[model samples]
Target: MTVPSGIYIRKARIQDVRTIHALLMDCSKQGLLLPRSYNQLYSHLRDFFVLAQDQGAILGCCALSITWDDLAEVRSLAVAPECRGQGWGRRLVEACLSDAITLGIFRIFTLTYQAHFFERLGFQVVSKDNLPQKVWADCLHCPKFPDCDEIAMSIEM
Candidate 1:
């Protein structure tokens, strides 16, 4: 097993599920992001974009879920603490944005507490009410649903 010194970003694969799930849970424990069950991760595994080292150690994971024909939400974005300052997060996000563009998605959104971080990537704050109602359909299952404290932000591709 070897590790890639340069950050390597790629689409999530079946084998990457557990690593991704662990990272998401770590972030979720600190409320940095939402947590996904193994079942859900498997169901939407392809929705994830990940950063892995040469030895295939996953550093972070993020997902882009199409909410409407023109809109997509960046969900479950979590970066490993030790890997936080290296820009792997930005890479993971750009990967998601790139995927959205490739899929003909023009509008991308996220609900996050890291306001400045996402803003640095050109995302702007938006009112949760301004977002489509369909986006809320998943709120029922969210730990912070209805009273979610995360700020809503969006970036145009």
Candidate 2:
């Protein structure tokens, strides 16, 4: 899908953290994703890719966090409601995937409720047990720990 004119994807900047946080918060309120604290977003700011207009209005965000030597997780994916259905979400994930490849990471996974969305991007459903134990460290902080219903999916580069 082609991105609309004036909207482009790029590495997230420190200034984008707050806007990104707001977008995530809205998604969280709707149970579309987990909310990220400002500290977490700041610390992992480099891991994010944002869809912003030429005028600096952030419309969406996604992150690719390296989890192991050869694995990374696609996390924090969200798109502003007004921007949905225009391919901004796909562009955000594609930006993360491109970054993962450039960093030499060939495997990417995501724990998400939108299984069909990720599946369309070539990710295959996988057992959560197939993921490394380290991945569960964050799960401990999740409200749905031990009972998470989010589907785990992965794609090989």
Candidate 3:
């Protein structure tokens, strides 16, 4: 799907971190996804792809963090409230998937509340146990660690 006119997806830049953090935080407060700290965002800045308007406002962001040799986790996906349903979120994810393929990784998984959204993008529900233990290291800090309600989904591209 093409991005909405005036909006485009690109690698996250250092200047975009604060806006990305704010967007993720807004989504987190609505119980949409996990929030990341400035530290985490800065450290993993290279993992992010952001959707921005032509005027340069960030509308959404997502990250593809490599988990194991053949696995990568899609996390921190968020789209502005006004921009939902316009295909911007999917575009952000596609950017990540493109990056993954470029890096020679084929398996992409996500712990998400929007299962149908990912499903439409070719992701399937999977058992959490099927994921590597190392994938949970960050979960240790999640508020829902022991009882995460987010559905685990994967797509082999």
Best by TM-score: 2
Give candidate 2's TM-score. Answer: 0.94
TM-score for each candidate, following the candidate numbering: 0.91, 0.94, 0.94
Candidate closer to the true structure by lDDT (higher is better), 1 or 2: 2
Q: Identify the runs in model 2 with alpha carbons over 4 angstroms from their true place.
A: none
Please write out the lDDT profile of model 3 over residues 1-157, one tens digit for every residue.
5545888888899999999999999999998987899999999999999988889999899999999889999999999999999888888898899999999999999999999999999999999988865346677787777788889999998
Instruction: Judge candidate 2 against the unseen true structure and give its global Cα lDDT, from 0 to 1.
Output: 0.89
For every model in order, what is the number of clashing pairs? 4, 0, 0
> lDDT per residue, candidate 1, 1-157, as tens digits?
2434666888899999999999889998997877789999999998998887777788888999888889888888888898887777787888889989999999999988899999999999998887865445677777676788889999997
Q: Which is the leading candidate under lDDT? A: 3
- lDDT per residue for candidate 2 within 1-157, as digits (tens), equals 6556898889999999999999999999998888999999999999999998999999899999888888899999999999987777887889888989999999999999889899889999999987865356577777787888889999999
Ranking by TM-score: 2, 3, 1
Candidate 1, pairs of clashing residues: 2-55, 3-54, 3-55, 4-54
